[model samples]
Target: MQGRNAGIFRIWKGVTVSQLIDAFERRFYYLRLSITDVCNFRCTYCLPDGYRPQGTRNTGFLTLDEIRRVTRAFAELGTEKVRLTGGEPSLRRDFTEIIAAVRANPAIRTVAVTTNGYRLARGVAAWRDAGLTALNVSVDSLDARQFQAITGQDKFHQVMAGIDAAFEAGFDKVKVNTVLLRDVSDIHLDTFLAWIKPRPLQLRFIELMETGEGNALFRERHVSGELIRQRLEQRGWRCQPRGRTDGPALVFHHEDYRGEIGLIMPYAKDFCASCNRLRVSSMGKLHLCLFGDGGIPLRDLLESDGALEALKTRIAGGLNHKKQTHFLHQGNTGITRNLSYIGG
Candidate 1:
């Protein structure tokens, strides 16, 4: 009985006997899974044409069971954290069920969801109950008209309500992610900061990257994180460097705010050297780098009743061959999917 209890405890702590063999040597154990390619709102950075791709005879959306199997396999490979991303994760009918399954797995420690916050108002509490630890909502502008203009959807009020609902749902942390463009959302920086000052939520300002379909926009309107910081400093906001986390967001604390701010400088300031994440698209392709084009498709392998140990070997091999840095520096053109397809 004691031995069995110890075994259960070990699994609960993500320290299984099989995990001890390889020692989970991967530098980063974070996994970003795209649950779907469907979204309700067509944000400028996401879907510029306000068009969602439809399924064809050759393409099919991944089922919830398939997602669970892939997630479980990754967990066994020592992925402690899993984030569900999408065209909008909430659009999936079984999103809550998937979250619950991932959370029920003892190997996964953190379960996060990134959304546009459209459905958060009614679904936030249910998602929490289903085992979501944190929520990251994309809100680029505070102005209603500007927000509608950027998202191509006049649902700013719905987004704001979703954010409030997330807070009300007792989420430990809620992050508001904004992609900073040169002259677009940059002007509303102060308004965003002021709004988040009293709340415990964190606001993340992301630099436009060249990986998405909006390559032209990225090249034409790229805004550096340093410039944003400078603008904040001019507003009497002092920033102190915070420690590193899994992703690219560089955190800072403000003097006047109870919350914090994060700068994700993917283009202007690259952190690819310490990059420690692998992205798995909804199609089951394993992407090593955010800027790279190569990915190992695991869907076929899993569907074939392939050996789990062999799958681990493939994952390890993929990580071992991961580029130390992305091709953003050399103008390398190997990338295939955009940020939306890969779930930013």
Candidate 2:
């Protein structure tokens, strides 16, 4: 807690840290932490493209040491996987420092990040060399015009260039995050497949979920994973599940393609039964549920002299409060921040 003292991470509220479990008996080994709420893209589902960020007094955010401290605490609690996110994590000035700190913890076996890929062309080499393990790049559409319409920018070529750079940098496990909007996300299948069929990366089609905006938009445009799989199957595309057990995605490879593809259909297909993750906000709140009502703030504890035990207490309480699944109980009241604030 104080200067990231080594032995300060001995316990999680006076219990074996690894034993931290939820009401469903789920042991969280993965943590998705937002490094910043700032981003550049204005995708319709996230922020309005080029929207000016709101300035705040507490914008000091978490210093590099503070991130390391909190990450260390979770790592001590059996968090083997940590993924950094933000409005765009690449926008962080200390992105590399944060990655370094995450990797420094020997207990953390894998460190990853999700970004818009605008800066990956230049940043990938640096991050890969810094021991960054994996990446999930957001590219809603492959068609230039559709991409511009979705992100309100003509940087489609630039982002694609960044992906090429990532490939050149040689990270093997890069994947794409495509939010399926009705008219916006259906890129020409032939063109899109041609682009990815030869590459080793996986393209994941995500069902659109309502965040700050209401469900009307989502209901109007959301493309179900079942539909995509059906269309592909109709086209004679064969798939076999890869049986991945580590991440949120359930991936499959095309019968004739070298790369793979997957779907994350939170709305259509429920994967909450096997969920094993905890998400921390950029400002130090422990989010028990990504779409839940609220979180427990840990800034005061992290900054105070006698903070470790208190942090453990709050963290344990947060874990206890973790929902069995989000938006599945009686009278569903969807609670989610804007995609940017929660880290797209």
lDDT of each: 0.74, 0.74
lDDT of 2 by residue, 79-162 (tens): 778899987888888898899989998878889989888898889999988878888898888878888888887888888888
Give lDDT for model 2: 0.74
Show the colliding residue pairs in model 2: 42-49
Estimate the Cα RMSD of every predicted model relative to the unseen true structure.
5.8, 5.3
**Worst lDDT 10-window in candidate 1:** 1-10
Summarize candidate 1's per-residue lDDT along 146-237 as a digit string, tens digits: 88988888899999998888888897578989988888868777677778888988898998776546778767878788888787677666
The list of candidate 1 runs beyond 4 A from truth reads 1-26, 52-59, 232-245, 268-270, 304-306
User: Which 10-residue window in model 2 sums to the lowest lDDT?
Assistant: 1-10
TM-score of each: 0.86, 0.87
TM-score of 1: 0.86
